[model samples]
Target chain A: MTEKKKTTIVLFSGDYDKAMAAYIIANGAAAYDHEVTIFHTFWGLNALRKDQQVPVKKGFLEKMFGKMMPRGADKMGISKMNFAGMGPKMIKHVINKHNAMTLPQLIDMAQELEVNLVACTMTMDLLGLQQEELLEKIEYAGVAAYLGEAEDGNVNLFI
Target chain B: MTEKKKTTIVLFSGDYDKAMAAYIIANGAAAYDHEVTIFHTFWGLNALRKDQQVPVKKGFLEKMFGKMMPRGADKMGISKMNFAGMGPKMIKHVINKHNAMTLPQLIDMAQELEVNLVACTMTMDLLGLQQEELLEKIEYAGVAAYLGEAEDGNVNLFI
Candidate 1:
Protein backbone atom coordinates (compact mmCIF):
# COMPACT_ATOMS: atom_id res chain seq x y z
CA MET A 1 0.00 0.00 0.00
CA THR A 2 1.19 3.52 -0.77
CA GLU A 3 2.03 5.58 2.26
CA LYS A 4 -0.17 8.61 2.62
CA LYS A 5 1.36 12.06 2.68
CA LYS A 6 0.99 13.97 5.96
CA THR A 7 0.27 17.65 6.55
CA THR A 8 0.81 19.27 9.93
CA ILE A 9 -0.34 22.78 10.84
CA VAL A 10 0.70 24.63 13.98
CA LEU A 11 -2.22 26.97 14.52
CA PHE A 12 -1.08 29.66 16.89
CA SER A 13 -3.49 32.52 16.22
CA GLY A 14 -6.97 33.04 17.65
CA ASP A 15 -8.18 35.71 15.21
CA TYR A 16 -11.37 34.71 13.43
CA ASP A 17 -9.86 35.24 9.98
CA LYS A 18 -6.70 33.31 10.74
CA ALA A 19 -8.68 30.46 12.24
CA MET A 20 -10.79 30.37 9.10
CA ALA A 21 -7.67 30.20 6.97
CA ALA A 22 -6.26 27.34 9.04
CA TYR A 23 -9.44 25.34 8.78
CA ILE A 24 -9.71 26.00 5.04
CA ILE A 25 -6.16 24.76 4.47
CA ALA A 26 -6.61 21.80 6.80
CA ASN A 27 -9.80 20.73 5.09
CA GLY A 28 -8.23 21.14 1.66
CA ALA A 29 -5.23 19.03 2.60
CA ALA A 30 -7.49 16.32 3.98
CA ALA A 31 -9.53 16.31 0.75
CA TYR A 32 -6.29 15.57 -1.09
CA ASP A 33 -5.86 12.41 1.02
CA HIS A 34 -3.19 13.68 3.34
CA GLU A 35 -3.12 12.86 7.04
CA VAL A 36 -3.69 16.22 8.66
CA THR A 37 -2.95 17.26 12.23
CA ILE A 38 -3.51 20.79 13.53
CA PHE A 39 -1.65 21.59 16.74
CA HIS A 40 -3.62 24.46 18.28
CA THR A 41 -1.58 26.42 20.82
CA PHE A 42 -1.62 29.75 22.65
CA TRP A 43 -4.27 32.02 21.20
CA GLY A 44 -5.37 29.18 18.94
CA LEU A 45 -6.76 27.47 22.02
CA ASN A 46 -9.40 30.20 22.19
CA ALA A 47 -10.92 28.71 19.07
CA LEU A 48 -11.66 25.52 20.97
CA ARG A 49 -13.61 27.14 23.78
CA LYS A 50 -17.37 26.90 24.04
CA ASP A 51 -19.38 30.10 23.45
CA GLN A 52 -21.03 29.98 26.87
CA GLN A 53 -18.84 30.16 29.94
CA VAL A 54 -18.49 26.77 31.63
CA PRO A 55 -18.06 26.29 35.34
CA VAL A 56 -14.38 25.23 35.39
CA LYS A 57 -12.01 25.84 38.27
CA LYS A 58 -8.73 27.59 37.61
CA GLY A 59 -5.90 29.51 39.24
CA PHE A 60 -5.66 33.31 39.26
CA LEU A 61 -3.83 33.64 35.92
CA GLU A 62 -6.09 31.08 34.31
CA LYS A 63 -9.17 32.81 35.54
CA MET A 64 -7.87 36.08 34.14
CA PHE A 65 -7.24 34.43 30.77
CA GLY A 66 -10.72 32.92 30.76
CA LYS A 67 -12.31 36.29 31.52
CA MET A 68 -10.24 38.39 29.14
CA MET A 69 -10.18 36.22 26.05
CA PRO A 70 -13.29 35.82 23.95
CA ARG A 71 -15.35 32.75 24.68
CA GLY A 72 -14.90 31.13 21.24
CA ALA A 73 -14.85 31.65 17.48
CA ASP A 74 -18.00 33.76 17.63
CA LYS A 75 -16.32 36.40 19.76
CA MET A 76 -12.97 36.53 17.98
CA GLY A 77 -12.00 39.87 16.48
CA ILE A 78 -10.17 40.54 13.27
CA SER A 79 -6.40 40.50 13.45
CA LYS A 80 -6.43 44.14 12.37
CA MET A 81 -8.88 46.98 11.77
CA ASN A 82 -10.97 45.68 14.64
CA PHE A 83 -12.45 49.22 15.00
CA ALA A 84 -13.62 48.58 18.53
CA GLY A 85 -15.17 45.24 17.49
CA MET A 86 -17.12 46.45 14.45
CA GLY A 87 -14.71 44.94 11.93
CA PRO A 88 -15.60 41.37 12.81
CA LYS A 89 -19.32 42.06 12.52
CA MET A 90 -18.71 43.50 9.06
CA ILE A 91 -16.62 40.50 8.07
CA LYS A 92 -19.30 38.09 9.24
CA HIS A 93 -21.88 40.00 7.27
CA VAL A 94 -19.72 39.79 4.15
CA ILE A 95 -19.08 36.09 4.69
CA ASN A 96 -22.78 35.42 4.96
CA LYS A 97 -23.45 37.48 1.86
CA HIS A 98 -20.86 35.49 -0.08
CA ASN A 99 -22.25 32.18 1.16
CA ALA A 100 -18.97 31.39 2.84
CA MET A 101 -18.92 29.19 5.91
CA THR A 102 -18.49 30.95 9.24
CA LEU A 103 -15.40 30.18 11.29
CA PRO A 104 -17.42 27.95 13.60
CA GLN A 105 -18.93 26.09 10.67
CA LEU A 106 -15.52 25.54 9.06
CA ILE A 107 -14.28 24.17 12.36
CA ASP A 108 -17.14 21.71 12.52
CA MET A 109 -16.44 20.73 8.92
CA ALA A 110 -12.79 20.15 9.83
CA GLN A 111 -13.89 17.76 12.57
CA GLU A 112 -16.20 15.92 10.13
CA LEU A 113 -13.31 15.69 7.64
CA GLU A 114 -11.29 13.97 10.38
CA VAL A 115 -8.65 16.63 10.70
CA ASN A 116 -6.93 15.94 14.01
CA LEU A 117 -7.56 18.87 16.36
CA VAL A 118 -5.07 18.69 19.17
CA ALA A 119 -4.96 21.30 21.92
CA CYS A 120 -1.61 22.17 23.45
CA THR A 121 -1.47 20.96 27.01
CA MET A 122 1.23 23.46 27.94
CA THR A 123 -0.88 26.36 26.68
CA MET A 124 -3.91 24.95 28.43
CA ASP A 125 -1.98 24.74 31.68
CA LEU A 126 -0.70 28.28 31.23
CA LEU A 127 -4.03 29.78 30.19
CA GLY A 128 -5.96 27.71 32.72
CA LEU A 129 -8.23 26.06 30.16
CA GLN A 130 -9.83 22.81 31.19
CA GLN A 131 -10.81 19.99 28.84
CA GLU A 132 -14.43 20.62 29.75
CA GLU A 133 -14.20 24.16 28.30
CA LEU A 134 -13.44 22.89 24.80
CA LEU A 135 -15.19 20.83 22.14
CA GLU A 136 -15.45 17.04 22.36
CA LYS A 137 -13.64 14.37 20.31
CA ILE A 138 -10.36 16.22 20.26
CA GLU A 139 -6.87 15.23 21.34
CA TYR A 140 -4.71 16.96 23.95
CA ALA A 141 -0.93 16.78 23.96
CA GLY A 142 2.27 18.72 24.47
CA VAL A 143 4.59 20.11 21.80
CA ALA A 144 6.46 16.80 21.63
CA ALA A 145 3.43 15.05 20.15
CA TYR A 146 3.11 17.74 17.50
CA LEU A 147 6.82 17.42 16.71
CA GLY A 148 6.44 13.68 16.29
CA GLU A 149 3.69 14.13 13.71
CA ALA A 150 5.52 16.98 11.97
CA GLU A 151 8.80 15.04 11.84
CA ASP A 152 7.57 12.85 9.00
CA GLY A 153 5.10 15.26 7.41
CA ASN A 154 5.56 16.33 3.83
CA VAL A 155 3.95 19.71 4.44
CA ASN A 156 4.25 21.54 7.74
CA LEU A 157 3.03 25.07 8.42
CA PHE A 158 2.61 27.49 11.30
CA ILE A 159 -0.53 29.57 10.82
CA MET B 1 24.03 27.68 -11.87
CA THR B 2 21.54 25.57 -9.96
CA GLU B 3 18.12 27.13 -9.38
CA LYS B 4 17.17 27.96 -5.82
CA LYS B 5 13.92 26.67 -4.32
CA LYS B 6 11.39 29.49 -3.92
CA THR B 7 9.18 30.14 -0.90
CA THR B 8 6.22 32.47 -1.32
CA ILE B 9 4.57 33.91 1.78
CA VAL B 10 1.26 35.71 1.41
CA LEU B 11 1.21 38.05 4.38
CA PHE B 12 -2.43 39.00 4.81
CA SER B 13 -2.57 40.01 8.45
CA GLY B 14 -1.05 43.20 9.80
CA ASP B 15 -1.06 42.34 13.50
CA TYR B 16 2.33 42.64 15.12
CA ASP B 17 2.54 38.96 16.09
CA LYS B 18 1.50 37.68 12.66
CA ALA B 19 3.84 40.09 10.93
CA MET B 20 6.62 38.94 13.21
CA ALA B 21 5.99 35.32 12.29
CA ALA B 22 5.90 36.12 8.57
CA TYR B 23 9.16 38.06 8.67
CA ILE B 24 10.85 35.42 10.85
CA ILE B 25 9.93 32.73 8.33
CA ALA B 26 11.08 34.87 5.40
CA ASN B 27 14.39 35.57 7.07
CA GLY B 28 14.80 31.91 8.01
CA ALA B 29 14.15 30.86 4.42
CA ALA B 30 16.64 33.41 3.15
CA ALA B 31 19.18 32.10 5.64
CA TYR B 32 18.67 28.63 4.16
CA ASP B 33 19.54 30.02 0.69
CA HIS B 34 15.95 29.81 -0.50
CA GLU B 35 14.44 32.40 -2.83
CA VAL B 36 11.77 34.16 -0.77
CA THR B 37 9.02 36.52 -1.86
CA ILE B 38 6.58 38.10 0.60
CA PHE B 39 3.41 39.44 -0.99
CA HIS B 40 2.01 42.00 1.44
CA THR B 41 -1.68 42.86 1.05
CA PHE B 42 -4.58 44.61 2.80
CA TRP B 43 -3.71 44.82 6.49
CA GLY B 44 -0.23 43.60 5.63
CA LEU B 45 0.38 46.93 3.91
CA ASN B 46 0.57 48.54 7.33
CA ALA B 47 3.85 46.70 7.85
CA LEU B 48 5.40 48.82 5.12
CA ARG B 49 4.15 52.11 6.55
CA LYS B 50 6.62 54.72 7.65
CA ASP B 51 7.21 55.09 11.39
CA GLN B 52 6.62 58.81 10.98
CA GLN B 53 3.63 59.60 8.82
CA VAL B 54 4.71 60.95 5.47
CA PRO B 55 2.95 63.87 3.86
CA VAL B 56 1.43 61.84 1.05
CA LYS B 57 -1.78 63.14 -0.40
CA LYS B 58 -4.58 60.57 -0.19
CA GLY B 59 -8.24 60.56 -1.18
CA PHE B 60 -11.09 60.43 1.32
CA LEU B 61 -11.12 56.67 1.77
CA GLU B 62 -7.33 56.43 1.81
CA LYS B 63 -7.12 59.17 4.39
CA MET B 64 -9.65 57.30 6.48
CA PHE B 65 -7.58 54.11 6.28
CA GLY B 66 -4.47 55.96 7.25
CA LYS B 67 -6.11 57.55 10.27
CA MET B 68 -7.71 54.31 11.50
CA MET B 69 -4.86 51.82 11.11
CA PRO B 70 -1.74 51.69 13.21
CA ARG B 71 1.18 53.73 11.88
CA GLY B 72 3.77 50.95 11.58
CA ALA B 73 5.21 47.90 13.27
CA ASP B 74 5.61 49.72 16.56
CA LYS B 75 1.97 50.68 16.49
CA MET B 76 0.51 47.28 15.67
CA GLY B 77 -1.60 45.30 18.15
CA ILE B 78 -1.52 41.65 19.13
CA SER B 79 -3.81 39.22 17.36
CA LYS B 80 -5.35 38.20 20.65
CA MET B 81 -5.28 39.20 24.32
CA ASN B 82 -4.83 42.78 23.25
CA PHE B 83 -6.22 44.03 26.57
CA ALA B 84 -6.97 47.29 24.80
CA GLY B 85 -3.43 47.52 23.32
CA MET B 86 -1.40 46.30 26.27
CA GLY B 87 -0.76 42.88 24.76
CA PRO B 88 1.56 44.16 22.04
CA LYS B 89 3.55 46.18 24.55
CA MET B 90 3.94 43.06 26.69
CA ILE B 91 5.08 41.08 23.65
CA LYS B 92 7.55 43.80 22.76
CA HIS B 93 8.92 43.62 26.27
CA VAL B 94 9.36 39.86 25.97
CA ILE B 95 10.98 40.23 22.57
CA ASN B 96 13.38 42.78 23.98
CA LYS B 97 14.17 40.66 27.02
CA HIS B 98 15.12 37.76 24.74
CA ASN B 99 17.43 39.98 22.64
CA ALA B 100 15.47 39.06 19.52
CA MET B 101 15.33 41.34 16.51
CA THR B 102 12.40 43.73 16.41
CA LEU B 103 9.93 43.59 13.48
CA PRO B 104 11.56 46.54 11.73
CA GLN B 105 14.96 44.94 12.16
CA LEU B 106 13.68 41.70 10.72
CA ILE B 107 12.35 43.55 7.68
CA ASP B 108 15.73 45.18 7.25
CA MET B 109 17.51 41.84 7.55
CA ALA B 110 15.12 40.25 5.07
CA GLN B 111 15.94 43.03 2.62
CA GLU B 112 19.68 42.63 3.26
CA LEU B 113 19.27 38.89 2.66
CA GLU B 114 17.58 39.73 -0.66
CA VAL B 115 14.10 38.49 0.23
CA ASN B 116 11.76 40.06 -2.30
CA LEU B 117 9.07 42.27 -0.68
CA VAL B 118 6.08 42.95 -2.90
CA ALA B 119 3.13 45.15 -2.08
CA CYS B 120 -0.32 44.37 -3.45
CA THR B 121 -1.33 47.19 -5.74
CA MET B 122 -5.04 46.53 -5.44
CA THR B 123 -4.87 46.58 -1.68
CA MET B 124 -2.77 49.69 -1.59
CA ASP B 125 -5.23 51.46 -3.83
CA LEU B 126 -8.10 50.26 -1.72
CA LEU B 127 -6.41 51.28 1.49
CA GLY B 128 -5.29 54.64 0.09
CA LEU B 129 -1.62 53.98 0.77
CA GLN B 130 0.71 55.70 -1.64
CA GLN B 131 4.14 54.31 -2.46
CA GLU B 132 5.70 57.41 -0.90
CA GLU B 133 4.15 56.45 2.46
CA LEU B 134 6.09 53.15 2.45
CA LEU B 135 9.76 52.26 2.36
CA GLU B 136 11.42 53.04 -0.96
CA LYS B 137 12.75 49.52 -1.62
CA ILE B 138 9.88 47.21 -2.62
CA GLU B 139 7.97 45.91 -5.62
CA TYR B 140 4.29 46.60 -6.32
CA ALA B 141 2.06 44.06 -8.06
CA GLY B 142 -1.41 42.62 -8.39
CA VAL B 143 -2.66 39.06 -7.85
CA ALA B 144 -1.36 37.83 -11.21
CA ALA B 145 2.16 38.93 -10.36
CA TYR B 146 1.99 37.05 -7.06
CA LEU B 147 0.52 34.01 -8.80
CA GLY B 148 3.39 33.97 -11.23
CA GLU B 149 5.83 33.78 -8.37
CA ALA B 150 3.70 31.25 -6.47
CA GLU B 151 3.19 29.00 -9.50
CA ASP B 152 6.81 27.89 -9.66
CA GLY B 153 7.53 27.99 -5.93
CA ASN B 154 8.29 24.81 -4.02
CA VAL B 155 6.86 26.11 -0.77
CA ASN B 156 3.91 28.51 -0.50
CA LEU B 157 2.26 29.79 2.65
CA PHE B 158 -0.45 32.30 3.52
CA ILE B 159 -0.14 34.08 6.89
Candidate 2:
Protein backbone atom coordinates (compact mmCIF):
# COMPACT_ATOMS: atom_id res chain seq x y z
CA MET A 1 0.00 0.00 0.00
CA THR A 2 1.14 3.55 -0.57
CA GLU A 3 2.31 5.42 2.51
CA LYS A 4 0.02 7.99 4.07
CA LYS A 5 0.83 11.66 3.55
CA LYS A 6 2.16 13.58 6.52
CA THR A 7 1.44 17.21 7.43
CA THR A 8 3.41 18.81 10.25
CA ILE A 9 2.90 22.35 11.55
CA VAL A 10 5.04 24.37 13.93
CA LEU A 11 2.71 26.76 15.72
CA PHE A 12 5.05 29.51 16.93
CA SER A 13 2.75 32.48 17.37
CA GLY A 14 0.75 33.26 20.52
CA ASP A 15 -1.87 35.23 18.60
CA TYR A 16 -5.38 33.82 18.79
CA ASP A 17 -5.94 34.28 15.06
CA LYS A 18 -2.70 32.46 14.17
CA ALA A 19 -3.48 29.54 16.46
CA MET A 20 -6.96 29.34 15.00
CA ALA A 21 -5.47 29.23 11.51
CA ALA A 22 -3.04 26.51 12.52
CA TYR A 23 -5.77 24.37 14.08
CA ILE A 24 -8.04 24.91 11.10
CA ILE A 25 -5.35 23.67 8.75
CA ALA A 26 -4.51 20.76 11.00
CA ASN A 27 -8.15 19.77 11.26
CA GLY A 28 -8.60 20.04 7.52
CA ALA A 29 -5.52 17.94 6.86
CA ALA A 30 -6.67 15.36 9.35
CA ALA A 31 -10.09 15.21 7.74
CA TYR A 32 -8.35 14.51 4.45
CA ASP A 33 -6.68 11.47 6.07
CA HIS A 34 -3.23 13.05 6.29
CA GLU A 35 -1.15 12.21 9.36
CA VAL A 36 -1.20 15.64 11.01
CA THR A 37 0.93 16.99 13.83
CA ILE A 38 0.84 20.50 15.32
CA PHE A 39 4.04 21.24 17.21
CA HIS A 40 3.48 24.16 19.56
CA THR A 41 6.58 26.19 20.40
CA PHE A 42 7.62 29.45 22.09
CA TRP A 43 4.54 31.63 22.54
CA GLY A 44 2.43 28.93 20.94
CA LEU A 45 2.72 26.89 24.15
CA ASN A 46 0.21 29.26 25.72
CA ALA A 47 -2.49 27.63 23.61
CA LEU A 48 -2.04 24.30 25.38
CA ARG A 49 -2.18 25.78 28.85
CA LYS A 50 -5.19 24.99 31.02
CA ASP A 51 -7.62 27.88 31.12
CA GLN A 52 -7.73 27.84 34.90
CA GLN A 53 -4.65 28.74 36.90
CA VAL A 54 -2.53 25.69 37.71
CA PRO A 55 -0.50 25.88 40.87
CA VAL A 56 3.08 25.20 39.85
CA LYS A 57 6.43 26.07 41.35
CA LYS A 58 8.73 28.35 39.40
CA GLY A 59 11.75 30.65 39.62
CA PHE A 60 11.54 34.42 39.29
CA LEU A 61 11.78 34.75 35.53
CA GLU A 62 9.70 31.64 34.89
CA LYS A 63 7.02 32.84 37.27
CA MET A 64 7.06 36.22 35.60
CA PHE A 65 6.70 34.61 32.19
CA GLY A 66 3.94 32.35 33.36
CA LYS A 67 2.10 35.28 34.86
CA MET A 68 2.58 37.46 31.77
CA MET A 69 1.32 34.91 29.27
CA PRO A 70 -2.33 34.12 28.66
CA ARG A 71 -3.58 31.16 30.66
CA GLY A 72 -4.98 29.41 27.57
CA ALA A 73 -6.24 29.81 24.03
CA ASP A 74 -9.30 31.73 25.17
CA LYS A 75 -7.22 34.49 26.77
CA MET A 76 -4.90 34.93 23.78
CA GLY A 77 -5.22 38.13 21.70
CA ILE A 78 -5.37 38.57 17.95
CA SER A 79 -2.27 39.33 15.92
CA LYS A 80 -3.49 42.66 14.50
CA MET A 81 -5.75 45.54 15.50
CA ASN A 82 -5.72 44.21 19.06
CA PHE A 83 -6.83 47.66 20.25
CA ALA A 84 -5.96 46.77 23.80
CA GLY A 85 -7.78 43.39 23.64
CA MET A 86 -10.83 44.53 21.72
CA GLY A 87 -9.88 42.80 18.49
CA PRO A 88 -10.38 39.30 19.90
CA LYS A 89 -13.84 40.28 21.10
CA MET A 90 -14.78 41.54 17.68
CA ILE A 91 -13.43 38.37 16.08
CA LYS A 92 -15.42 36.21 18.49
CA HIS A 93 -18.51 38.24 17.70
CA VAL A 94 -17.96 37.70 13.98
CA ILE A 95 -17.40 33.99 14.51
CA ASN A 96 -20.62 33.77 16.52
CA LYS A 97 -22.53 35.72 13.91
CA HIS A 98 -21.37 33.34 11.21
CA ASN A 99 -22.17 30.32 13.38
CA ALA A 100 -18.52 29.31 13.15
CA MET A 101 -16.34 27.80 15.85
CA THR A 102 -14.30 29.88 18.26
CA LEU A 103 -10.65 29.12 19.03
CA PRO A 104 -11.54 26.84 21.95
CA GLN A 105 -14.08 25.02 19.84
CA LEU A 106 -11.52 24.66 17.08
CA ILE A 107 -9.06 23.13 19.53
CA ASP A 108 -11.73 20.73 20.70
CA MET A 109 -12.47 19.79 17.12
CA ALA A 110 -8.77 19.20 16.52
CA GLN A 111 -8.72 16.90 19.54
CA GLU A 112 -11.83 15.05 18.40
CA LEU A 113 -10.33 14.63 14.95
CA GLU A 114 -7.27 13.03 16.61
CA VAL A 115 -4.83 15.69 15.47
CA ASN A 116 -1.47 15.19 17.15
CA LEU A 117 -1.10 18.20 19.46
CA VAL A 118 2.50 18.50 20.60
CA ALA A 119 3.99 21.08 22.95
CA CYS A 120 7.67 21.97 22.62
CA THR A 121 9.13 20.97 25.94
CA MET A 122 12.06 23.38 25.66
CA THR A 123 9.74 26.34 25.33
CA MET A 124 7.52 24.94 28.04
CA ASP A 125 10.48 25.00 30.42
CA LEU A 126 11.40 28.47 29.27
CA LEU A 127 7.86 29.65 29.92
CA GLY A 128 7.64 27.90 33.33
CA LEU A 129 4.78 25.64 32.28
CA GLN A 130 4.39 22.25 33.89
CA GLN A 131 2.54 19.17 32.74
CA GLU A 132 -0.30 19.85 35.14
CA GLU A 133 -0.83 23.26 33.58
CA LEU A 134 -1.44 21.86 30.12
CA LEU A 135 -4.30 19.90 28.64
CA GLU A 136 -4.12 16.15 29.10
CA LYS A 137 -3.42 13.74 26.22
CA ILE A 138 -1.00 16.09 24.43
CA GLU A 139 2.57 15.08 23.63
CA TYR A 140 5.72 16.95 24.65
CA ALA A 141 8.78 17.07 22.43
CA GLY A 142 11.70 19.21 21.21
CA VAL A 143 12.89 20.73 17.93
CA ALA A 144 14.66 17.53 16.98
CA ALA A 145 11.36 15.67 17.10
CA TYR A 146 9.77 18.38 15.00
CA LEU A 147 12.56 18.29 12.40
CA GLY A 148 12.33 14.51 12.23
CA GLU A 149 8.61 14.66 11.52
CA ALA A 150 8.90 17.65 9.15
CA GLU A 151 11.73 16.25 7.03
CA ASP A 152 9.50 13.41 5.89
CA GLY A 153 6.30 15.45 5.85
CA ASN A 154 4.46 16.07 2.59
CA VAL A 155 3.53 19.47 4.01
CA ASN A 156 5.52 21.03 6.84
CA LEU A 157 4.50 24.48 7.99
CA PHE A 158 6.07 26.78 10.55
CA ILE A 159 3.11 28.99 11.39
CA MET B 1 18.89 10.55 -9.91
CA THR B 2 16.71 11.17 -6.87
CA GLU B 3 14.28 14.06 -7.03
CA LYS B 4 15.41 17.26 -5.36
CA LYS B 5 13.49 18.17 -2.23
CA LYS B 6 11.27 21.27 -2.33
CA THR B 7 10.72 23.92 0.35
CA THR B 8 7.97 26.49 0.01
CA ILE B 9 7.27 29.32 2.44
CA VAL B 10 4.18 31.52 2.68
CA LEU B 11 5.42 34.71 4.30
CA PHE B 12 2.37 36.35 5.87
CA SER B 13 3.93 38.50 8.58
CA GLY B 14 5.28 42.02 7.99
CA ASP B 15 7.64 41.88 10.99
CA TYR B 16 11.37 42.20 10.29
CA ASP B 17 12.41 39.27 12.45
CA LYS B 18 9.79 37.02 10.86
CA ALA B 19 10.98 37.98 7.38
CA MET B 20 14.57 37.38 8.42
CA ALA B 21 13.67 33.91 9.69
CA ALA B 22 11.86 33.13 6.44
CA TYR B 23 14.83 34.27 4.30
CA ILE B 24 17.35 32.51 6.51
CA ILE B 25 15.47 29.23 6.16
CA ALA B 26 15.07 29.77 2.42
CA ASN B 27 18.78 30.46 1.94
CA GLY B 28 19.66 27.46 4.06
CA ALA B 29 17.36 25.17 2.10
CA ALA B 30 18.73 26.49 -1.21
CA ALA B 31 22.28 25.88 0.01
CA TYR B 32 21.28 22.28 0.75
CA ASP B 33 20.06 21.89 -2.88
CA HIS B 34 16.37 22.19 -2.06
CA GLU B 35 14.23 24.11 -4.56
CA VAL B 36 13.06 26.92 -2.28
CA THR B 37 10.24 29.37 -2.98
CA ILE B 38 9.08 32.19 -0.70
CA PHE B 39 5.52 33.34 -1.47
CA HIS B 40 5.10 36.83 -0.04
CA THR B 41 1.47 37.53 0.92
CA PHE B 42 -0.51 40.07 2.92
CA TRP B 43 1.88 42.18 5.00
CA GLY B 44 4.73 39.97 3.82
CA LEU B 45 4.52 41.84 0.49
CA ASN B 46 6.06 44.87 2.20
CA ALA B 47 9.40 43.11 2.21
CA LEU B 48 9.44 43.30 -1.58
CA ARG B 49 8.56 47.01 -1.80
CA LYS B 50 11.20 49.30 -3.24
CA ASP B 51 12.75 51.53 -0.61
CA GLN B 52 12.12 54.57 -2.78
CA GLN B 53 8.58 55.92 -3.21
CA VAL B 54 7.08 55.15 -6.64
CA PRO B 55 4.41 57.42 -8.08
CA VAL B 56 1.45 55.02 -8.34
CA LYS B 57 -2.23 55.88 -8.57
CA LYS B 58 -4.32 54.71 -5.62
CA GLY B 59 -7.61 55.15 -3.73
CA PHE B 60 -7.70 56.88 -0.34
CA LEU B 61 -7.47 53.66 1.68
CA GLU B 62 -4.73 52.30 -0.54
CA LYS B 63 -2.75 55.50 -0.20
CA MET B 64 -3.10 55.32 3.56
CA PHE B 65 -1.97 51.69 3.55
CA GLY B 66 1.01 52.49 1.38
CA LYS B 67 2.03 55.36 3.66
CA MET B 68 1.54 53.23 6.78
CA MET B 69 3.41 50.09 5.76
CA PRO B 70 7.18 49.94 5.72
CA ARG B 71 8.68 50.62 2.29
CA GLY B 72 11.19 47.77 2.45
CA ALA B 73 12.66 44.97 4.59
CA ASP B 74 15.01 47.34 6.38
CA LYS B 75 12.17 49.50 7.67
CA MET B 76 10.09 46.60 9.02
CA GLY B 77 9.74 46.19 12.79
CA ILE B 78 10.37 43.17 14.96
CA SER B 79 7.64 40.83 16.15
CA LYS B 80 8.25 41.68 19.79
CA MET B 81 10.25 44.03 22.02
CA ASN B 82 9.88 46.73 19.35
CA PHE B 83 10.13 49.53 21.90
CA ALA B 84 8.94 51.97 19.25
CA GLY B 85 11.50 51.12 16.49
CA MET B 86 14.38 50.74 18.89
CA GLY B 87 14.13 46.95 18.64
CA PRO B 88 15.07 46.87 14.95
CA LYS B 89 18.07 49.11 15.59
CA MET B 90 19.22 46.82 18.39
CA ILE B 91 18.76 43.76 16.19
CA LYS B 92 20.80 45.42 13.40
CA HIS B 93 23.51 46.30 15.88
CA VAL B 94 23.63 42.73 17.14
CA ILE B 95 23.77 41.35 13.61
CA ASN B 96 26.65 43.70 12.77
CA LYS B 97 28.50 42.83 15.95
CA HIS B 98 28.20 39.13 15.08
CA ASN B 99 29.13 39.72 11.42
CA ALA B 100 25.73 38.40 10.42
CA MET B 101 23.79 39.56 7.35
CA THR B 102 21.08 42.18 7.62
CA LEU B 103 17.61 41.59 6.15
CA PRO B 104 18.36 43.57 2.97
CA GLN B 105 21.68 41.79 2.54
CA LEU B 106 19.92 38.49 3.09
CA ILE B 107 17.38 39.38 0.38
CA ASP B 108 20.24 40.21 -2.00
CA MET B 109 21.88 36.90 -1.17
CA ALA B 110 18.62 35.07 -1.80
CA GLN B 111 18.46 36.69 -5.25
CA GLU B 112 22.02 35.66 -5.90
CA LEU B 113 21.23 32.11 -4.75
CA GLU B 114 18.33 31.94 -7.24
CA VAL B 115 15.69 31.47 -4.56
CA ASN B 116 12.23 31.92 -6.07
CA LEU B 117 10.80 35.16 -4.60
CA VAL B 118 7.11 35.38 -5.51
CA ALA B 119 4.77 38.20 -4.53
CA CYS B 120 1.09 37.29 -4.05
CA THR B 121 -0.76 39.25 -6.72
CA MET B 122 -4.03 39.23 -4.79
CA THR B 123 -2.51 40.92 -1.71
CA MET B 124 -0.62 43.38 -3.87
CA ASP B 125 -3.92 44.53 -5.36
CA LEU B 126 -5.57 44.76 -1.97
CA LEU B 127 -2.62 46.70 -0.54
CA GLY B 128 -2.59 48.97 -3.62
CA LEU B 129 0.98 48.04 -4.54
CA GLN B 130 2.02 47.95 -8.16
CA GLN B 131 4.79 46.25 -10.10
CA GLU B 132 6.80 49.48 -10.24
CA GLU B 133 6.67 49.72 -6.45
CA LEU B 134 8.28 46.31 -5.92
CA LEU B 135 11.80 45.11 -6.52
CA GLU B 136 12.92 43.93 -9.94
CA LYS B 137 13.26 40.27 -11.06
CA ILE B 138 10.65 38.85 -8.69
CA GLU B 139 7.53 36.93 -9.75
CA TYR B 140 3.85 37.62 -9.01
CA ALA B 141 1.37 34.80 -8.29
CA GLY B 142 -1.70 33.73 -6.31
CA VAL B 143 -2.76 31.04 -3.76
CA ALA B 144 -3.22 28.46 -6.49
CA ALA B 145 0.43 28.77 -7.46
CA TYR B 146 1.43 28.50 -3.82
CA LEU B 147 -0.71 25.38 -3.22
CA GLY B 148 0.64 23.83 -6.41
CA GLU B 149 4.21 24.31 -5.16
CA ALA B 150 3.45 23.37 -1.57
CA GLU B 151 1.58 20.11 -2.20
CA ASP B 152 4.78 18.38 -3.31
CA GLY B 153 6.96 20.32 -0.89
CA ASN B 154 8.84 18.66 1.94
CA VAL B 155 8.80 21.91 3.85
CA ASN B 156 5.84 24.28 3.44
CA LEU B 157 5.91 26.96 6.10
CA PHE B 158 3.60 29.93 6.65
CA ILE B 159 5.54 32.64 8.45
Q: Which model scores highest in lDDT?
A: 2
DockQ of predicted candidate 1 = 0.08
lDDT of 1 by residue, A2-89 (tens): 9999998978888889888989999999999999999887789889999998997775556776888889988887877888869999
lDDT of 2 by residue, A1-159 (tens): 988778898999999877876786687678777788999999999999999988878899988898899999999997765546566776676566546678899899999999999999998877788999999899989999999998888888777
Q: List-wise, what DockQ does each model earn?
A: 0.08, 0.26
Candidate of highest DockQ: 2
Worst 10 residues of 1 chain B by lDDT: B89-98
Local distance difference test scores for all models: 0.84, 0.86
Q: TM-score winner among the candidates?
A: 1
Give candidate 1's total backbone clashes.
0
Model 1 Cα lDDT, one tens digit per residue, B125-159: 88888888888799999999999998877667788
How many steric clashes between backbone atoms does each model show?
A: 0, 0
Give the lDDT of residue A41 in candidate 1.
79
